[model samples]
Target: MKLSSEQIKQKLKDAGLRVTPQRHAILEAVYTLGNHPSAEQVIDFIRVRYPGIATGTVYNVLDVMVESGLVKRVKTDKDAMRYDAIMNRHHHIYCAESDRIEDYFDEELDELLQAYFRKKKLQDFKIEDIILQIKGNFNDNSE
Candidate 1:
């Protein structure tokens, strides 16, 4: 999802983050990558267009984005931390063999899980959200 400068600014504002030229460029880099990218990947992407951007700034922006619900942190099976740009209610379909992650959306699944959890009603622990990472091998022929 390629985000325009105005869209990026709005997103930053919505997240209550102070927008700066550097932050705008970094966020644009994340959207340009599209696929879930790690901090190093984000830095690499930004450096091509912005050679002067500090590596620490990329990491800091991502941390703030995650905290402010602008982006999400996805941890792979190998414990590699990746950044996801999608914010809607959805899950991830992960391919362990390929280390690939795809967004999964199932309204029925969501309803069922909610019903089950509501029935259980575990004490003292409130459910903020539920994100399931279904792991399997991606069928190469599906394409």
Candidate 2:
């Protein structure tokens, strides 16, 4: 899921953001890290390329990105905040033991859930996006 620098700048443009060295590097970092990176993880990654970048800058950029729907946030059971670069609608498979999160996409399941929820038609609640966090061990091969 790697993106070229031009593609990264295009994403920023689409998000109506001005492209700066830090913004470009941060967006690329989010995609390159590719592990639902936390703020700390993103900072570490950006720091390698941008040694003088500030922690606050990274956090502020992440907030802006999230607000613009450039990335989605994932919180582990331990309350660790993580960021996902994949913008498409998808859920997560969380492994508690390893603290790893993987994207899961199932169109049929999405349709089923949507239909079920639509049938309920709860008042005063607008369904914006459906996200599910499935928690378990990734390598559970026990008999």
Q: Which ten residues in a row have the lowest lDDT in candidate 2?
A: 134-143
The count of backbone overlaps in candidate 1 is 0
| lDDT of every predicted structure (CA atoms) | 0.88, 0.89
lDDT tens string, model 1, 85-111?
888889999887778888898999999
- For 33-96, candidate 2 gives per-residue lDDT tens digits of 9989999998988887679999899889999999998988888877768898898889999887
TM-score, one value per model: 0.92, 0.94
| Residue runs of model 1 more than 4 Å from their true location after superposition | 141-143
Q: Return model 1's CA RMSD, one decimal.
A: 2.0
Which candidate has the highest TM-score of all?
A: 2
| Clashes by residue pair, model 1 | none
TM-score of predicted structure 1: 0.92
